[model samples]
Target: MNMLIFKRFSLTILILGTLVACKETNKNPQKKISETITSETQNDFLGNYVAKEYHQRTEGYDWISVAVRNKGDNTIGISVRSRADKKRPTCTFDSKAFKVNDSLYRACSNGVGILFSFKKDSLKILTEIPEQADALQFYCSGGGNFTGDYGRIEGELDSSQIDPTLFTKTLELQGIGFSVSSFARNNKKILQILPYGLEIDNSAITRTLEGSIADVEIEDLNSDGFPEILVYLSSDGSGSYGDVIGYSVNNGKSISAIYFPPISENDELKKGYMGHDEFSIIETTLAQRFPIYREGDTNANPTGGIRQIEYQLVDGEASRKFVIKNSTDFPEKN
Candidate 1:
């Protein structure tokens, strides 16, 4: 296995979805909190929040900004950024935060976990352990103090203050990890993926994306002891069509892609298929589900019920492909 000794300042790649994820080491096991939180209570935390010295702007003064969004199923994704300066004055923490209480959530980046405490229109961060506050200096200049306090911004965050990173995430399994990020450059949406801990060097993967990324999942689908990374993407606009990009570690040495044929190319599966698909790793199989569309149906509603298709990852003539294992249809519910 790769000799990755997590130290006082080890890198913990963090991933978040809804289009992007960033990297960071999760120093501790994920918090096992009650699953009884309501959607309304969670939605209260979604917004663009900003921090300014004296609650007012000063010439040539820098600032910190936080953006919060819901990742569906009661998950909250938070991003913290700051105006870059000459030195390593940049502070970045992007990850899905776990709810700790009605007014608090905790997120970790680079082995240092911090709590998000919300009160009224303002928000502040306190480290899970007081000593860890000193570690935050690793992300900034001169080993300074962590500075991220903000009042909810009424609208969007000022474009000039935040960096161009739109989405990022890192997913790991069996000691292998993939750091992913998406940004706009030269009018094109670019997707960059980098992998670490392979005996053979796996160069970073970069390509143009037709649609925005939705989520990324990792699993050893074939029980190979190695891991595979699955990236789900969704098209913009009403259709919200979904697709997957997969990479499998080659015998614990290298990486390769898994072929996923388009539904429009298949006669049996495309009979009543539209967009709006969902994908997940269910035990040993990759499962996809979507509302079945019949003739004269609008995008909003489909009366034809739902269709679920499960695929098993198997070797093809050369690389790998997800072969359909089972397909089922359920009638529309009342």
Candidate 2:
């Protein structure tokens, strides 16, 4: 009878041990599922994506790509490329994974970033550009965290868009010492206008004028009949506010820069506002406007006033015709 009791006790102990081990495994299954979800989501998010809405070379990018590189931990790298010229990628935004959802992951740096939703094969961008060093506000009104959606592109990814061949053009200029003279070449024939700087053959120069080339338009802002190369540069600080300068070509090879007064809030004249700059060839003048901001104000609630700083070609140079206070229209010639 004593032997039977001892066997029964041993069996009871074995059963209890098995039950405890199973309970422990069940308790931690959720953690394992979370890690698996992260890995899978990242893998799916790694690929090429293009903009849903059509954008020209002047407005923004035609395609944006996300590259997942193994930097010990997984990293999401984003590059915004231009449609007109291939040598144009805005900036390489490198950041680690921010948050992992069931099917999406977010990675951000500065105030600008992109979110990858794997379930939908879509990318959402939150852009908060900085103001230029010459602007008054820390950030511009038109540049804080605007949302943009993009769709996935199939295949092995268009390597062409990733590594675009930089194009070079030849031109000439006269005024040798002006600030915009940086865009003018005294000798070199091939001119490469890159996002970071201007290069004339092997002699590469960075930040020669303002910053990288944000937008390039061939409109005659100086009303010279011939198309002038209006190169819009990226802002210095953190807003979408960029500076614009014009260059007109003589014959097919000679070119010169269009000089205008500094139209920014930080200007000595204090004529412009603290906002993003927009330029257009309206009629015979260059129409310029920027959203107005007050002291200690956020971009969300600007003063609802727009600063109009129009320019016209006077004596073959861009001259500020008039600086309006809060209206889009420049003062009548009267």
> Which candidate achieves the best TM-score against the true structure?
1
Off by over 4 Å in 1: 1-43, 52-58, 85-89, 96-149, 331-333
Q: Put down candidate 1 lDDT per residue, 45-108, tens digits, no spaces.
A: 7897887642443365666677888754335777766665423335665665766567666665
lDDT of 2: 0.41
Per-residue accuracy of model 2 over 1-334 as CA lDDT, tens digit each:
2323423433344334323323422332222223334335456666666665333424544444444432112334344432334443432233334334555444332222234445456665532122211121112232222235667767654544443422222222222111211232343222343221122222322334444344344444444444455655545564566576565544333455566556544453354356466554444555555556667667655553544555665443343222333334232112
Task: Enumerate residue pairs that collide in model 2.
Answer: 129-238, 129-239, 130-238, 130-239, 131-238, 131-239, 172-255, 195-212
Candidate 1 residue-pair clash tally: 16
Each candidate's TM vs. the true structure?
A: 0.73, 0.39
Candidate lDDT values, in order: 0.71, 0.41
